[model samples]
Target: MRGIQLSFNKTQKLRLDKALEQLEYFSSKLNSNAIVTVSDTIPVNHEDGVLKGHGTMELEGEVVATLCGVVERVNKLVYVRPFRARYKPEIGDIIVGRVIEVAPKRWRLEINFSQDAVLMLSSMNLPDGIQRRRTAVDELNMRTIFEEYDVICAEVRGFQHDGCLHLQARSQKYGKLERGQLLTISPYLVKRQKQHFHHIDQYGIDLILGCNGFIWVGEHVEVKDDMIEDQTNKSEQQNNKLSGLASHQNQEHNYTPLELRQYICRAANAVRVLSTLGFMITVDKIMDAVEMSTSKNLNIHEMLGAEFYVLVAEREAERRSSSSKKR
Candidate 1:
């Protein structure tokens, strides 16, 4: 017989036998009887009544009596839950991603979960400076740098507030990767690491494993002796031509070697600064930082010429003004 019972509050007390009698009378209309017996305090709500077990009769809140019913078979296996959230990228996580789009300044990478990651122009190392305008030849050679469907190991810089991850590859260990078979895997399974570059010694290949699920593999090989001999012969011939041109320039301008070295050093430093920051490094910004270290009043026009430095200086001034306004 299965029946429902209500337990009295703490201030109320009634004999169990009397309670059972009242329950039977109340449940008779439903064709059930309250079976009275002892039971352990199996936790039941105030609506629950006596089942079969021996337990205490003390009631602090509400007491309820439950009616006994026929026993049914029970299943005992534990259940597992499923994950229900999108993937969140962290620094140094390995991921398998695909190139979705490419622009002159950046590449859009689909990392397989949320929004695509951006690989900025400053994060790459081209033969010329970042500001060097591309020529027709450069456009033809663009694929020599990176092409569509090419996979690379990239580091996650950070994520936008809307959850887009930014990527960078300015180190020698990264950029212009070649000769590697790509691998794909689930982003969640890839473990985050401190460094993105790693050599798979067991496989005899260098792997740039990304936390976004991208992987690049390349084999170690040495240049052949015959190829080195031919390259050396060609380089010597070019060196002779360059020497003749240098002598002509020296006689015409009397340019000091020290001045030339200074210009090269400044340009290299500017490139390094921009690469490290993974953003635009205008000429004025570079000149400002350079001027602070030198006693001489350096002419920006003389250093970088008129056209190039003018554009860079304008950008730098704008950046400074915007920053100052924010502060």
Candidate 2:
């Protein structure tokens, strides 16, 4: 949250400090820090037969935390949730990753986890809208589907026998992401929810909240089965028709309206501001911040200014305070 470097004037710094202090007070009162760091032994009722969970190890008959995070207890089960660590993928988690290698029958992705995730050619829906076993030709033409360095969205398909993660993009909503700004934030800030894909129709933007902390803000693309046709069209293009088709293609896809681009940037900057404040990122919170900036007539570029940050902090403090009261 405060991991990002920011500049603030004397007054702005004071305002930020006060707002943060208020936030701290509210959070401290609500959550009494059932937290521990590495090597800290968690006090448990041994007579109840404590069972150690992930992030805990029995050291000298004491349950010691192996990570730095909040401690959670459920009856006889005890575990810690790491505050700052690599993303741990769970079954059905939506993730965003970059393709690192296109190997035989599978593509390796860097998913911000300990090991690279595997996207088997068969695990994903092909452009032809057909479901079948992936053939040898599919292996050879894997680049046509996903090239190296392409950013993709998928769900956790579980781990391989050797411990590498596996992913699946079996639906239209999951695939190569394009014409979007990819944002990186701490994984802890993104809480799991019933929905991760958000379409802000007001701005024509689609926001994907990856459990692994990769966020995409981009113009929404209609889900269609035209990917194969698009690929075929690309391969068939020759220098003879390049000049004429280039202009058409550029006019169709390359040009994003200035207004839409501004909106995208504005939304992206709102996310940055929230992340910088160390707040939990949710679609509602992001949209609220964006709406606030819009109501103030703040330009997209100005949203990242120090004054806006202080304003956002104050807003967050007030919001949290009210929320705590409601609870």
Candidate 3:
């Protein structure tokens, strides 16, 4: 019942009746039913007896039907049917993501997909009671508002012609996340769900469930408290340690939060052992370049549901820039 047959001419239409005749030569037709499907697009109507492209015909008990039209040609597997479900991100879809890199115009987000999506600076809403075009200063300060490792809620702005998705958070509910652990899941699963982003109101945990197989979660109270404590500690530690070092150590290290996250991801994955632990491990050590390299290796791109290479070209560029400035 399962076999492959080819059509020789592009102008011919492999009608149901003609297909049955060809099939009859291979198998008996007595007490058998047949169904047909065109594996490729045929001329609107061709009278030639020759079959064109590929097609499938099925015969079951007493039922006979043709599932026709253009077919996907990969191997030879043909379906005499259509898939009932398809995956596509829609507007207002709530997704969770990790900041992968920040360029001048936008932030590249690794939404756990083959292509990292983009969130443009224009898509972000101004803080409450402050309305003005985002200036260079605002762009530079962007990281101060949303740093690397910060989880955020956002809406799907739409997809680019090349299939890259764009996200925007213009409302109070869509910006600067306070708490939650991000969970990555398949984009297909997110598309199938009635609600893409789920607020864990019951558990009182904020979460951004990205369609790209990335999710962010944090404990509400702890995130805020820790952020403040971490900032103070970082300043104190930097001052105490740098006092003993040369003034050259005071060079500014500027990067968007997303860029930092990308660096951390790369560094965490570079470690031989941690590379196998997967992408969820957080790398907090800021001073060790070797650790950062190991982490970066683990930040693989999830394209077509498979793990692919991570986007580290930007990280390399940053490193070169930093080195040049130091010299």
Displacement of the residue 73 alpha carbon in candidate 1, Å:
40
- On a 0 to 100 scale, what is the lDDT of residue 84 in model 1? 18
lDDT of 1 at 131: 29
10 residues in a row with least lDDT, candidate 1:
76-85
Write down the lDDT of every candidate, Cα atoms only.
0.46, 0.86, 0.44
Point out the higher-scoring one by lDDT: 2 or 3: 2
- Give Cα distance to truth, residue 152, candidate 1, Å: 1.9
lDDT of 3 at 220: 30
Top-TM-score candidate index: 2
For lDDT, candidate 1 versus 2, the one ahead is: 2
In model 2, the clashing pairs are: none
lDDT of 3 by residue, 227-313 (tens): 433355545656744662443345234323554444333332232121221212222211233334445443322211112112222
Q: Write candidate 2's Cα lDDT for 1-327 as tens digits.
A: 456467788998999899999998987777666768899989888899998999999989899999888898898999998776667789999999999999889999988777789999989987655556888888888898899999999999898797788899988889999877999988888999999999999889999999999998998887754464345444354442466467656756767788888888988998898887888899888898899999999988889888898899999899988988898
TM-score pick, better of 1 and 3: 3
* True-vs-predicted CA distance for residue 18, candidate 3, Å: 46
User: Mind giving the per-residue lDDT tens digits that candidate 1 earns over 57-171?
Assistant: 3345533223233111123211111111236777655454566777666677777665788876666545322324546676556566666776655667787676568887644
User: What count of clashes does model 1 give?
Assistant: 24
